[model samples]
Target: MFVSKRTFSTYRALFHENPLGLPRHKPAPTIPRAHRGLPKKMPIAGVKNVVVVASGKGGVGKSTTAVNIALAAAGLKRRVGILDADIFGPSVPKLMNLKGEPELTEKGDRLIPLTNYGVKCMSMGFLVDQDAPVVWRGLMVMKALQQLLHQVDWGQLDLLVIDMPPGTGDVQLTISQQIVVDGAVIISTPQDIALIDAVKGVNMFKKVNVPILGMVQNMSLFICPNCQHESHIFGHDGAARMAEEFNVPLLGQVPLHADICTLSDSGKPIVISQPDSPFSNYYRSITQNMLNRLQEIK
Candidate 1:
């Protein structure tokens, strides 16, 4: 007697049709699933407007811009808060020089955001160990994000600046799908590689119906600390050209400066550290342009 081996796919094929060329009924076609409409957007309780600072790629000064812009708005006497939505790589904690777990509200329901330099802030960095890696899957990440968004008590804020993780990924999608995002500010360096990703970032917001507030050209130029000479180390006019092509405003260009980096690492962003410095003025200008765009959209 002869024996034969058959795999799962072969077994499936045998049941679906006759191998001996005998007539058999065809298998039913799969009906396409209906598309679920967009999720209902819920507004954060005390936030008047939600602005997310995003970038197509990482290392383009997005987190720095988010912190400084929020600080700049606060400097203008508007209540502002910064939410580090970058679950895997939270930067606000180090940038804001804040640590320790958040305390519960009086009702013992929500976590109170940490405050420093007159701006409220919340980040995953505050909850976990500084060196521990977030080696979890997507589902686990989403759950963590939900708690951060809804369980933080920010009191009253004129603006809630969300520092989103770089690229168009799960966290970005969840935030856009779940919340009423007032607008998005895209950040990019004046380099072709970075600008390519920045374009995608702008398009992603447009597809989700989030207004494109403007783009910030970070590291547009590097100024020598010793000598007052400007260098376009990352290429010149890349983001400016892209902005015109996309028809979005060019908020401002921030030069690559040593003080900006050192101050941010020390939890003293340039806006507050050197308010009179030209670098500080760059951030303030960007903040003003962002506010104007928000008003126009409204």
Candidate 2:
């Protein structure tokens, strides 16, 4: 194409204005030096100690263990509450058989946690419909997590168990950086696959300076109900070895039992449904170990 003299002159003028035909570079924004410090960890009001139950991946009975642990703690005559931190898949409502949105406190500044079976509970599941999905980005999730962490009236509990979402991601880091967690209970099946992820979770807590209370091995054994035979379903002592390797205590092992699943699904955890049952006893033992670990941390 041929350009007219006027058009060629215009192009020349544009080139002179910006030889590269690109906008001039501007300095990147900087944060104030004083504001660059890491955020201070805040303690949850009315909560004496906070313990997070976490896993490396999903499908590891982490929530089940958490619920039973809270119930067991309550059974031991200590005030206990559980917070379901899995905003995307909150299971505390179903596990605790709680429903409806939480009521705001008299000051209208905090949410009142729901109570059941002598244990208080809170979760995003209670705030939204059970069947609905939490389709939110990272910012929204972090905001909701902040609300759950600090804006709840727990009413002076001895222990607050947080059910962390699976994986090492934004929510995990945010929780670690925001609150002063007393300890963490890493849950996993007795499988290399699961233990690998559990290792990551352990490292994450360590990096954040949260004390690792110990590890719990779920589905460690499957007793044949009919034959009275014991079987190592996933593998034997996987978590125990992991605990030894990591130099953390091996809290306890929870056998794989159909009743545990059925009872939990029915909104009646084993500890509450069958308090004297062996499964309940396992959870009670784990809770005791956790309490001991927390005491040591203190």
Candidate 3:
């Protein structure tokens, strides 16, 4: 309810009689359509077919897998873009060998994403110094994410890969709740601790009604080139077992390839540099499975 003009004079006269530094009240500011609370994570918008690559925990080659899969999608002649939403540790810029900051186009306020290996890429590393620590609060992180989503002109893309932070907490919720994600890919190491966390991640997406594309097994095997023998370092088919138990598809398994880590960390994805490598073939197969799954869903 608003005060009428006739009543405004009465309140002003009353405040003047008191003369105790009390001023007449005015109308309140605009109220939003939705009530907002203090969120540990911020919701974002303006993305199409956002595919979140999530894991239960960290240090499981999640980021590397995301990069490779993104490249694989691009290989199909589809327009693809990747958003490095990992605030704590952003490795996309380095993995794709993208250098320099994103160029601001003069026409629209669209941020021109840097390209490497035929895929558009964006990362927090591109905004700040490489060695600088991102000591930002939730709101700050939210603002940054919002800018990345809206400010960047991604153009028309078939899929946008979001490499979410490794956890089921605030950052994860912020991305899940705010963005219209098509599906999620859970990456897990073949171990007890990682699988436990991976299950939690899968459930989190389920609660929010996001479809599980499948679970990918990383570091499932290690084949030494010297002997050309395969060894189960983390145990075989752990991810496949978990997927069956959870009633989700086991998308594919990736071996613990030394070259994948070495090439990605150095900013040259193995798919682009060594297209004939076995690791690249695994990722390519996973991409095809995802396509088939999408068709089934439709």
Candidate 4:
């Protein structure tokens, strides 16, 4: 479904009026008790659906896609939140234009999630100094992932989009085994190298029994802004063929647009920055398709 201009105007006005830096609320610490061993899956306290956005490798615009999806879901009036599961390289804070350490709830135990563009967000980037490197071993990463998954006060959200770290490693396994993921969306470019890794991601999720919602082919094409000519910089229909071979749906293809990158780097993702643009429409359509798939699964 396309977002109407009136709706965009309303959203823009609401965002400008509300602003960021929401007041923190006091609440009792709500951390769950530790289990003896990892159970099959643990559900988040208030989140109804935990949708993880993953990529086989890094630098495939996975984080960008995840941020846009979360924002798009918010634009659709769904109660949405985003969790940055990329412990080693969390990008949600920058993409959402949020920074600084999260304030503790009035109870002093629960962490309050920061808000931007009307979407609640939690990220490791907020916890540590942005310049500091996240030099941690496998076990430490797992522990951090556990806390990020269960500790944040996400409130009551219809959907919590998790920006997972690239690859199918300990973090992925821990999340799939410990947290109850409703489904996962794979992001990849329309290149053979990226698709190879994307396949590994698909296989990894399948092994853990996580439902693959679909695949998003990002950077599929580049259009000259001035000339308005379209070019398939990366091979076209690669993701489509891969989807058919894997029996997964091709959610949508996002063209390579300079505005998408510039706006994202400036901390105003294209979805919210240029809601009326064709690029924004592509993201909205992809989000709608994912929502439809979710409904079907339910």
Q: lDDT for each of the candidates?
A: 0.84, 0.84, 0.76, 0.83
On residues 218-278, what C-alpha lDDT tens digit does candidate 4 reach at each position?
9999888888789998888788889999999899999998899999999999999999999
C-alpha TM-score for every candidate: 0.88, 0.87, 0.83, 0.87
TM-score of decoy 3: 0.83
Residue-pair clash count for candidate 2: 0
Backbone clashes under 3 angstroms, per model? 0, 0, 0, 1
* Root mean square deviation (Cα) for candidate 1: 14.6
Write candidate 1's Cα lDDT for 64-131 as tens digits.
Answer: 99999999999989999999999889999999999876766544445678899999999888766799
Which candidate gets the maximum lDDT versus the true structure? 1
**Residue 66 alpha-carbon offset, candidate 4, angstroms:** 0.6
For model 4, the superposed segments whose C-alpha errors exceed 4 Å read 1-38
Residues 1-298, model 3: lDDT tens digits: 3222221123224422321111213211121234564223222233446789999799998999998999999998878889998876898988888767665544423456788877888887776668978786766666556556555657778888989888898677766765567889999988888999999999999998788999999999997867778899887788889999999998999998778878887888888889999889999998778767755664
Candidate 1 positional error at 16, Å: 42
